[model samples]
Target: MAQQTASPDDSNGPESLYILGPFMFLGIVFFIVRIYTRLALSYKLNVSDYTNAVAVLAATITFGLFITAIVHGFGHHSFYITPEDSVIIFKCLYVVLTVGLFAAVFARISLACLCLQFTTSTVPKIILRAQIIFQIASLIATAVVTWIQCRPISAFWEAVPGGECFSPPQSWAFTATGIASDLVCAVIPILVISKLSRSLVERCLVCFLMAMSLFATAAGVLKIIYSYRFDRDPSDALRDMMPLFLWCRMEEVLLIIACEAPFLKSSIERVLRRMGLPVFQQKTKDLNSIHTFPDPRGSQGEAVKKDKGMKIDERKLEACEYTTSEDSTQSDESDGNSTRQQHGEVTDSSQSQPMSTPMDDV
Candidate 1:
């Protein structure tokens, strides 16, 4: 086969680094800052944080593999690369696709875990858990399909007599499922935000941040669309499929960023408060809206009755920055109970104790 000359419009691979480099940098920076805030500010980590960490790890590895692929003629015309470089590029791309899906799934998992903290409702929990299970199973199947997409496996990277490859739909099944998962993760938080009694500013802020996951979904859609272009020319696959990889990276990195943004917002609020700045506090209309769970002892009504003129605790309100109030709830309950008792209205001690909700302390 005579090597075909590339056209003027063909990409030579190096230019991709400029776009992907800054994306990877921002993602790693956000991941580090989130970890620091969790440890130094909250002094704790939860399931969500740990899951987000896994996402960051997988994404970082995928980014590294992407750079390797670029060096191996990823963005160039197929005939422009030597046989050895082509093989290397194919192998690197295979790993990138497989590992990039893992990053997307884990990022969605992290966001769902965080949203779960805001609601004890059984329906949303079931929905989120179901989504997680579906994503994991679909990705596992996708990985298996990717491994066997081309017969003998080695045929995936190197040409062999009688080698065969699966159709595109088989390879794209997980991507469709992934888009669904992203939408589910983003929309669930909006439902939670609607029921929250926070001010319009706070509600809008939370809604906006949570909805940012849709950008990843949009990228996934574009990835699928560009993938169809692969059928345009088999000999020009390296150049033709470049958009697929670009959109794939964009989808993964966007999910990681969107998942972490809400937590980072809370951390920033804490920092601003510490510096004595007038930060936007989570304001509630009444005691009923502050806690998600109902009082086990029916003390909520009693507390409200005793403190009709509720004194908004700046300390408690300030600390309840995120969707859940794990830190400030106990203190607020204590303050309410003491004031009630100080009014000389004696009640049964056993049944009148305040409720304590156990949540992922943001």
Candidate 2:
């Protein structure tokens, strides 16, 4: 709770910073893994990847501002904050709103670009175009509301005798639009997957993967709900609205992660196998296998005898077939014995065609 019209004497408390820890830690880890998988493992990252990187950067700034605001009395009861401290916190809040809005917009745009990777259809392309246009429009609207919400802009930090400002309703409407955009982005992917001719389990799996965007949607909604406290008290608004600010950063971080997860199917399976869980076990064929033919100058009788005695063992080449990662053939320990046996057997036969590595990037 805030004290009524306090003097500018001192700042206090870091409770808000402590509250932001888990969300920041998890978001950073997810972003790092997604980047490593997209760049190191998948080998072809798109615009979505770059945009999400920017979003993560923006979210990190917002996270810092949350901590900065706390140091200036954000998490403290208003009595501890002076009028001078209130001014500083207000400036921090402005930065948070400006950067937080960008983080959300960039993340959704990244998600929109992600959807473009899947569909080559004309209709879906048009729908994606429409989504992009809406995104641009929403971005402009949010920016307008943010910068102009208070007249004589500095009035936002320190109230002016003659300055006028709009109510929170316009801001609420913009926040609501952001939350709706998150929901739409999430639902569109699920709807697209639902139309594919896939089994129930596969469809459910895809839908659930796409539905990870719901976490962002839920975060956006909560951000709006908590932001209502903004009008509660100017001196302590930053402390009171900490939950809203925290969720705002979380929305972008989670969206970046959830959007990239589907493409990391191979990477995730590789990790699971390393952890000793049976997953993506491949049965590879000895494509480097040899087929000895009778020498042009050799006798037919000798060739027949060699052919009659030589029989290829029925080995499971599982290691080579479904091992989608390029590094998997050498990195997989379980496949070591099979790979060695396959190579030794090939030595006993005549070298046929050179083997080619088979793989499909998801």
- Output the number of the TM-score-best candidate: 1
Off by over 4 Å in 2: 1-16, 194-206, 228-238, 275-362
How high is each candidate's TM-score? Answer: 0.76, 0.68
Per-residue lDDT tens digits for candidate 2, residues 1-362, read: 33344445433334445545676676677777777777775687778888878878888888787777777777565666678988888798889888887777787788778776656567866877687788778778878887887888998888798887676466677667667766766777777766554445545665676667888888777877777656654545545666666676677667766766565556666777799976642233332333222232222222223444654432432222333344654554344323233322212222222232111233
Worst 10 residues of 2 by lDDT: 343-352
Model 2: colliding residue pairs? 7-82, 8-82, 8-83, 282-318, 282-319, 283-317, 283-318, 284-317, 284-318, 284-321
Q: Which ten residues in a row have the lowest lDDT in candidate 1?
A: 338-347
- At residue 161, candidate 2 shows an lDDT of 85
TM-score, cand. 2 vs. native: 0.68
Model 2 misses residue 57 by how many Å? 1.1
Who wins the lDDT comparison? 1
